[model samples]
Target: MKTLVNTLMMRVIEYFASKDMSQITHTLCVHEYTRLIALREGYKTRKVLLLELAALLHDIGCPRSKELYGNCLPVNQERIGAEIVSEWMPAYGKLAPKEIDWLVKVVGTHHQLPMAKEYGFEALFEADLIVNLMEGYYPKEKAALYEKNMVRTASGKALFELFFHHGKMDIKSD
Candidate 1:
């Protein structure tokens, strides 16, 4: 499993590296935050790996979106990303069919706050949002609202507070 994951990681890194350096950086940052939140939440290794993969590929459609629409809006990205993951992962990563389906669902609904918990993508969602916040994609003032509405895992809330609020926001634990 580790070897397969390593191979897939390398493929993903190469894919993004060839396309856009900044996107690769964003993907890596989201993956790191996903790792931290998943580990801190006591998730087993397999689940963490799945979440990490989702994180790495969350924005996979951005380049295609730009090509098609001239802008990578979240809606367009999610749609194109799901298609790309559905087609690409099986050929390149050899993930289980069910795992591929889950990945498709996750990539499809990444920006839809309500589907995160429903699709078991809480970690991926929070991690992506955290990286977006750091990248100034979201206004800093809205961090608390995100915490209250979208964040669910204790680890996610804690990390959000630490990064966006300087560890000072009194976010109630999930």
Candidate 2:
């Protein structure tokens, strides 16, 4: 199952693999972070699996959007990405129809929504925020603002504190 999951992740990334390695690396980190956060929160296995998959494919539409619009705007990417993931979900195998739809929604609205509050969506959002903060993709003030106002999960809140607030490396046990 793990191998199949990994293979599916790669296949999804292949849709528009960036020449720059940063995007791929960021996605991988978000996947790991999402899994870690989910595990820490004691999320069930299937939800963790879905959240990890969302983390991997959240930016899958960026390359496609660039191809079509000459720029990967978050709104465009979110819209197009929903279409892409909807098509790709069945290829991953064994996902129920509802699970596929739910994942498609997660990937589609990941950037546009203010907050979802669902376990998988919250995990994905926080994991992406961690990468965005560390990579300087988001300004510290803005990240802090979001952390204060938007972060909803206990695990996510703890991670934000660990990475951005406390500046510590004791993430795994937290």
Candidate 3:
């Protein structure tokens, strides 16, 4: 399973690299953040693998989004990413039907905030948020707001503060 996951990850990275090297960096950062949070949160091996796969593929729709919409807004990315994963995963023969369904949901809803948590995507959400914040995708005020609202796990919150807040704000967990 691990080897298969690694192979898929490399394939996805290659795909991202061909389109945009920056996106490959973003994907790797998000994947690392997801791994840290999931492991700290005590996710089992299978769950961690799922999270990693989702993290790698979360922005899979960006190229198509740019081509079709001339922008990669979350809405377009979500829709196209879900479609891409749904169409592409079966050919890889790596994931079961249920796993593919969950991956589709995670990729599809990764930008939908609390709703994504319902699909067991909280870690992916946080991971993506952290990377985006670091990359200055959000304004400072908006980043702070997102940190307060979206970061749920201890590991994620800690990373957010360390990277964004610089250990200044005393964030209380819900």
**Using TM-score as the measure, which candidate wins?**
3
Q: What are the clashing pairs of model 1?
A: none
Candidate 3: C-alpha RMSD after superposition = 3.5
Once all C-alphas are superposed, what RMSD does model 2 give against the true structure?
A: 2.4
Error of 1 at 166 (Å): 1.3
Q: Could you tell me which residue pairs clash in candidate 2?
A: none
- Please identify which of the two predictions, 1 or 3, would achieve the higher TM-score against the true structure: 3
TM-score of each: 0.91, 0.87, 0.91
Per-residue alpha-carbon lDDT of candidate 1 for residues 50-141, written as tens digits (9 for 90 to 100): 88888888999998898899999999999999999888888765578999999899999999878888888788899999989889999989
Question: Residue 143 error for model 3, in Å?
Answer: 3.3
Q: Could you give the C-alpha RMSD of every candidate to the true structure, in order shown?
A: 3.3, 2.4, 3.5
Residue 56 of model 2 has an lDDT of 81
lDDT for model 1, on a 0 to 1 scale? 0.86
TM-score of predicted structure 3:
0.91
Q: Of the candidates numbered 1 and 2, which has the greater TM-score value?
A: 1
- Cα lDDT, all candidates: 0.86, 0.78, 0.86
Clashes of each: 0, 0, 0
Question: Residue 56 lDDT in model 3?
Answer: 89
Model 3: residue 54 alpha-carbon error in angstroms: 0.3
